[model samples]
Target chain A: MTDTQNSRDAVVIERTFDAPVVLIWRMWTEPEFLKEWYGPDGASIPIANMDVRVGGIRRVCMEMPSPNGPMQMWFTGEYREVVEHQRLVYTESVSAESGPVLSPTSPGTAGGHPMMTEVRVELEAVGNRTKMVMTHAGVPSDSPGAAGWAMALDKLAANIATNRGR
Target chain B: MTTAIDEDRLTETFAALANSTRRAILARLAEGGATVNELAEPFTLTLPAISKHIKVLERAGLVVRGQRAQYRPCVLDATPLEAVSTWADRYRPVWEARFDRMDDYLRQLRRQEGASEADD
Candidate 1:
């Protein structure tokens, strides 16, 4: 079945790959494999620090060539659910290179997307092939305003943690 | 990267929308403009309570009340909603592109495995 049904608020993509389920899972969980195929065309992932467990941290930075210059994008998330090769759920957020986690309620970067969003991935083995379903719910994570908002929130989080210790 | 979307205004718009009462009010307003009393008629909520909802919508630029007129009606501006619509569909394509790259990489991996098996 094709990934033909999806709504605007949440995006769902389904694909079948020739690789076995274990290798597909490794491609996602392992940073080395992830760097080889994560990001848009012509974009390079210089950083892919993934701890691939429940409550583990995931930090990724992707760099792309632009008319003005090469731009780097940073994002961080925590793995909320990890069911080995079958499923994974994580909360993705635009983050600073310093890697401060922003609250879901925190304002987003440009385009008015949510500061934090959730991504769910499910994998199934079909004979020797792997079927993967990925769902990303919330605003698309991009826009140049991310750096400013991330830095401001980084300081805000520091000061707030200083006071609340949360 | 950065476009013209205002971060604060967008936050305010969502915050303004984060209430059931306000959402109901918007749904009611969508039919047409209504006076404060008329808008309050559907709910058991008091006039002031409904008025507070209207104020929030008004502040978010979703509702515009007529001024200098005896019969002021709350009008739905819909511009912010329009802004929301403009950016809503962007997330899907980004992931689609990455998945395209993934498909290519998976093919390459299969090729390498086939090569190694041949060597053996």
Candidate 2:
């Protein structure tokens, strides 16, 4: 069935940091700082290529240890918006290295557009604290891809909180 | 009961939602409760097939089907979807952070590469 259904579902996470907006922005926009925190607890992102301009592409390969086994997924998409130190928006579709995306909803998307999800992140400076809010949309309400994305996000969060490098 | 949930429940709930058909069914029910016949009307599948699908959804506790006047009306049980949202909420920052860092690294690499080429 051709699922043309569109739902504006979003996931928002707000974090108030004890640091300045510039430092927080650096953690987000700098690769060196990113490597310190960007994945689940056990998983690591060894490959990342990005261009933060409008219409530019951001690509990364993620590897994680799963109970079923170790797995990898390539997240590739284009930048929709980039504001120097305030906000960024991008859309991503997951695909495999040498194969089509496993998600059925997103096809021809970088690899296998099995599932397509849009992400928006906003950083608000409140005094010396920085409040960051992130929204993830376009996840099909019932697609397994959403679930996978959810799992990946969980690991991604732990990866960030425990990041000792930055 | 607002008890802490397990990973298995989360996984089951997400797996149940992986199908577009199931999502459609959920969306339909979200508009309001609907009977098996009403739900199946939109699809070309057989009544028993839709029933089976409902069973999967029911097992996931995403919907609470009630029998009313010869109709099995399904109500949306957003609990599981909430779980899914919670799971996604945990990692949104990590990915955003990664993307941000990646962008900077690539720009830096590109700049260095350009400068080297200029020197050559």
Candidate 3:
């Protein structure tokens, strides 16, 4: 029995990079650069395809090495708003299609259980540094995929700021 | 064991830490392990009440309990707490971006007002 209903949970990640606001925004929109730094340490992005336009769907899958075995997660989202180099908003769902399904509580729990998520990415300039904030709202409190997504984002930011510390 | 540390686990952990009393209990455990009596000594509630709070903490993996004779000792588990720090550190840029956006909006308003003043 599914005890979880849809709930809104917000996570704000603010990082100041030595690069300009535009450069930082590029790292997010460009599929090639994003492929270099999107998932966790061991997770790799074999599929980084994006339409980069409004109402366009971007589907990316991550290959994660698990102790039990190797696993793959399909992160499919639609680009709701794509403002030049300032702000980007997208709604991400676990299913391969456009509708909802059973929510996956964790990373490996996706096939039978699926959860929907929405992420907003904003970029602004702070003095010589650029600050980017991505807020993820409407994640199930009991879903495992939510936690995996948080980790993946953290690793992604670190990979971007590996050299330039601000 | 829900060994998988994911968003759901984090929410449950944070919700458990949302309580001030439970946070204090964690602070106490950090110093060293303690039993129900020792854990409840600093609290205003009874031992049974503290036990309930400890149970919540244990479920979140913030604290671990061991059976020793008649007393169950609680140990501080810092692994799950690090998850919050790791996740928050990712968005240091996002906050700066928001602040800059606000600053630009204010600056533009000032510039527009000055232009009107010059026209007058």
TM-score of each: 0.74, 0.48, 0.43
**lDDT for residue A163 in candidate 3, whole number 0-100:** 25
Ranking, lDDT, top scorer first: 1, 2, 3
The numbered model that scores best in DockQ is: 1
What TM-score does the A-chain of candidate 1 achieve?
0.68
The TM-score between candidate 1 and the true structure equals 0.74
Model 3: per-residue Cα lDDT over A1-166, one tens digit each = 0111111135555656666677667667777656556665577778876778888777777677879676666667677799977888876544322223323223223443333456788788887567777676544334434443433433433433442253
Candidate 3 at A16: error in angstroms?
10
Residue by residue across B17-96, what tens digits does model 3's lDDT show? 65668777876776678998998998789878999999999988988999778787998777776665544344344444
Supply the global lDDT for candidate 2: 0.63
Model 2, position B27: C-alpha lDDT score: 69
Model 1 chain B is weakest, by summed lDDT over 10 consecutive residues, at: B1-10
Error of 2 at B59 (Å): 18
Clashing pairs in 1: A143-B1, A144-B1, A144-B2
lDDT, residue A143, model 1: 36
List residue ranges in candidate 3 displaced over 4 A.
A1-60, A63-71, A76-85, A89-120, A124-166, B1-12, B44-46, B82-120
Query: What are the per-residue Cα lDDT tens digits for candidate 1 across B10-44?
Result: 55665666666776777666667889888999899
Q: Looking at candidate 3, what is the lDDT of residue A76?
A: 70
Candidate 2 per-residue lDDT, tens place, A1-166, comes to 0121111134555566656677677765565665556665676778777777888777777777768676776776767899977988877655544445433233223221244556777888999767877666645423534544434433433333344234
